[model samples]
Target chain A: GQQVQQSPASLVLQEGENAELQCNFSSTATQLQWFYQSPGGSLVSLLSNPSGTKHTGRLTSTTVTKERRSSLHISSSQTTDSGTYLCAPFNVGDNSKLIWGLGTSLVVNP
Target chain B: EAAVTQSPRNKVTVTGGNVTLSCRQTNSHNYMYWYRQDTGHGLRLIHYSYGAGNLQIGDVPDGYKATRTTQEDFFLLLELASPSQTSLYFCASSGTGVEQYFGPGTRLTVL
Candidate 1:
């Protein structure tokens, strides 16, 4: 079975500071997705980057398929960005299954 | 908007009781999945279906059964539930792409 590991299980930062989260997988991945889980536990997809760097607003995701690793960067974080960030990667042969990381809990202080 | 909705956002059941978690996706996706999220284990897939009347076992399918009665409906059944089964359950749907849309989640507690 494939496994996904996220770095810095938890992090806290000032409102204007930048945050970086890392994700590493045990096997080759065909698709990589970043998700934000609100305090109430609702999940929202942030980005899907399998091999290249992608940016949406102040969040950026970079994935290196051959390296089996990915990263999520948040710039000038705000209090509303506080939540758990999850990284999931789809195994090469598994179409409907995704290997999920334990998640990086971020807290943006005022 | 395309979305996935789950029923009975919260549930409480006794040990050995039967519980059913329902999920409906208006996105008209062919692939639907059931996952459970715990404190440190993250999200583990329980079951999935590619289409109506189709079912596939996931990584953690023990003591659980799933049914896809229609393209828009998927159900997770817990027959004789236990306390260990108490966790937040999430239902997700995806089309041909890898991106999956998740439901609000159902918090189930087995007493």
Candidate 2:
């Protein structure tokens, strides 16, 4: 069974601070995606990066396929960004399936 | 925007009761998936389909059955619901790429 491990299960930061989340997979992955799950449990795809750095607004995702790891960086965190961040990596052989991480719970305080 | 919509945002059922969760995707994507989210388990895949009439077993498909009647519709069936099956279920659709668009999610409670 393939596994995706997320580090710093939970994070707390000031509104203006930055947050870094790490995801390490047990097996090789062809693509990596980051999602933001609101407090209401709705998920929204943030970015999809296979091997390089990708930026969208204040969020940046960097995936190193060779290292089997990915990182999501959020700059100038805000209170609205308080939610769970999930990392899902597509399985190497099966592109239809994604191995999901336990998610990094982030709480940005004012 | 890729839209994935799910039905009956919330459900409650007794043990052994049959429950069906519906999903519709307007992205015209070829892949659809059903997953359950728990407190510590994150998101666990229950079933998936590459296209209409194609069913693929996911990691956690024991207590669930799924059907893809059309390219825009997919359903997950819980023939005999149990308390342990209570969780937030999400339906997602993706195309040839790796980005999966998720629905608002359905919260199911079995007593």
Candidate 3:
């Protein structure tokens, strides 16, 4: 089974500090997406960077298909950014299913 | 905004009881998915459908059955719920390979 692994199960950062979350997959992915889940809330799509680099506002996602890995970079994080960042990979081998990572619980403190 | 709505945000069922969770999407997306979230398992896909009347088993499909009778509706069925089925369930929809818009989620507890 192709697994999506997220680094640093949990992270605590001061407000305005930068945060970096890593995601690695075991198989080649045709689609990759980053999702943010607030405390006891539903998941929200943060960015969809299947390949290459993409930036939206203060969040940037870089996916290197050759390496089968991706990273989510948050610049000048805010308290509202305190949530769980999830990585999901689609199209694992013959199966076209999304494999999700456990997620990185990030806390941006003031 | 893409709207994905789930009914009965919270549910409590006794062990061996039957349970059903409903989901509706107005975005007219072709793909719909059902997943469970737990402390250990972040999110495990239980089932998905490409369109109305089409069902596909996901990685964690055991003990669960799903039905997609209409393009706007998808349902998850638990014939004999167990304690292990207690978790937060999420419904999502997407078009092509883009990002999936998820519902508020349903917290189900099988006591």
Candidate 4:
């Protein structure tokens, strides 16, 4: 089965610093999604980038399908940004086949 | 935006007990999925359905059974729950396998 591997399983950063999370999948995909989960909360979709760069708020998602990887960049991080970030890549025709990453646990200091 | 809702956001059951989790999607999405979330396991798919009356086993389907009674409803069953079955569960729906939206989630504890 295909799997998603994320770098820096856990991270701690200062409030004003920037954070970059990486996601690498084991399969080819046409679309990939980035999700955020606050402590003890539900998953929230951050972005759905096809193959290039996408921006939402201070978050930027860049997907390179040919490389089977994507990255989520968080700029000017805040304590409220503390949470887990996950990524999933799926075949467009069969989104149900997507693989999920364990996620990058981020903690921002006040 | 997609709306996925789960009932009884929390549950508790004893070993060998029976449990059921319910999910409803109003977006008329054809793809629905049930997943369990553990500390390190991330999210493991337990089952999924493409439409009403359709069921597909997911990667982690050993102790779970699911039903899709209508286009808007899906349910997961645990006939004999165990301690290992305790985890946070999420229900999601996709309009076409893309941009999946999730329900708040249900925390189940099998004591």
| Model 4 alpha-carbon drift over 4 Å, by segment | A92-95
Per residue, candidate 1 scores C-alpha lDDT tens digits across B1-88 of 7799998899999999999999999998999999999998999999999999999999999999999999999999999999999999
**lDDT string, candidate 4, A43-85, tens digits:** 9988898698999899998888889889999999999999999
Can you write out model 4's per-residue Cα lDDT over B1-111, one digit (the tens) per residue?
Answer: 679999889999999999999999999999999999998899988999999999999899999999999999999999999999999999999886768889999999999
Chain B, candidate 3: TM?
0.98
What order do you get sorting by lDDT, best first? 1, 2, 3, 4
What digit string (tens of lDDT, one per residue) describes model 2 on residues B1-111?
Answer: 889999999999999999999999999999999999999999999999999999999989999999999999999999999999999999999886378889999999999
DockQ of each: 0.81, 0.81, 0.74, 0.77
lDDT (tens digit, per residue) of candidate 1 on A1-110 = 78889999999999999999999999988889999999878998899999999999999899999999999999999999999999999864975588899999999999
lDDT of 2: 0.92
Q: How many backbone clashes does every candidate have?
A: 0, 0, 0, 0
Every model's TM-score:
0.98, 0.97, 0.97, 0.96
Among all windows of ten consecutive residues in candidate 1 chain B, which has the lowest summed lDDT?
B93-102
- Residue runs of model 3 more than 4 Å from their true location after superposition: A92-94
**How does chain B score by TM in each prediction?**
0.98, 0.98, 0.98, 0.98
Candidate 1, residue B103: the lDDT equals: 96
**Range of the 10 consecutive residues with the lowest summed lDDT in candidate 2 chain A:** A90-99
List, residue by residue over A5-109, the lDDT tens digit for candidate 2.
998999999999999999999888888889999998999989889899999999988898999999999999999999999998886586468888999999999
Q: What would the TM-score be for candidate 1 when compared with the true structure?
A: 0.98
Candidate 1 C-alpha error for residue A67, in Å: 1.3
lDDT score for residue A51 of model 2: 94
